[model samples]
Target: METSQALLIYNMASVEKCPETLTAVNASSKQLNCSIDTYGNNQYMCLPNAEKSSLVEFCYNGIMGIQVEGNCLEAKDGRVILHSCKKFLSGCPKKPFFNYDFYKYPACQHINLKHFCYESDPSCQALENSGGFNNVSNDNRDIMYGLIGGLLVLVILTIVIAGFINERRWKRWWWSFTGVGNEPDRKPDKTSGTTTNPGL
Candidate 1:
């Protein structure tokens, strides 16, 4: 695909980290209002239902994807759903999972990953091809920058050339206005062997 087409796809992945508010659905099908809280490890957590949950802590680790406990969440329609494994049954069951709505997150519109949660989803397939666009976008950006630089150089050259031409014209005008260097060539007349004045 062309770089422009790939850029559109790549831009879709660049999302905002925070928004005015966030909404989520818990395992109980209860709608929860979540808030963002940043920590020291370049990680952040979501506090659900206006308070903290002891059993379920939704945190986003910058390295991978969003996670609750240790399990990765599946992204869909700008939201992430956590499918708990059997071992974490005490915290979250396999039946109904915890879903966090990151639709309001401006930096990243969507998150896609191949994990325990809905691995067969189409978004997961997109993740497999996401790597190709990065390099393509970088090359395109470099080309764009080069084009801008070349235009700047052309503008400078144009200004320099215009200045040189204008300076010559201005000097000629000034000399004529002041009647300087307007004298005719004072050559001797061949027949008379003497200089002749045109005014005489």
Candidate 2:
């Protein structure tokens, strides 16, 4: 019997803390929307209705496909290999999880890790590999082009038809005003005993 390969997974954990490192903070409080300090850490002093400062900590963990030396985690070929054991940790609020200077260890500098992992999932990977999104985008582009082309053709046709109608109307008005087409030839004025030349 053949054994199946183990599928790698990514996981994230988060915790909120108050001024005291060991004390837990309420996540549902409206005052959590405080401003961050210059160092990118949350300013506990800005928390409204708060008696003390607070911070949030996030930890990441998972298994790496390959072994790495030292404390470095592998982020090769856009894959993150978690080297650290899954452990609950604390850190300053507003700081990123991968900031080595603030919260040490298991650090890899892949920005947007959550998005990368989501795309790497088997279902999403299949769609991407098969050009699902690409196909949709292409289809949308084609539809837009077709609509623009059709509108341009309609506008041109309208302009041509309008010009034709205006030209006919102008000809009719000019003929009526000048009496050019239906004028009768002048006849002799018998009562005055005078005859006018037809050419004149």
TM-scores across all candidates?
A: 0.28, 0.29
Candidate 2 at 128: error in angstroms? 21
Q: Which stretches of candidate 2 lie over 4 Å from their true place?
A: 1-136, 181-200
The TM-score measured for candidate 2 stands at 0.29
For candidate 1, the 10 contiguous residues with the lowest summed lDDT are 1-10
Best by TM-score: 2
RMSD of each: 16.8, 15.9
lDDT of 1 at 104: 32
For candidate 1, write residues 59-105 as lDDT tens digits: 33233233334332333322334333233313232232222433232
Off by over 4 Å in 1: 1-136, 182-200
- Compared with the true structure, what per-residue lDDT tens digits does model 2 show for residues 32-103? 443333444332210101111222232222221223222223222223333221221211122224322222
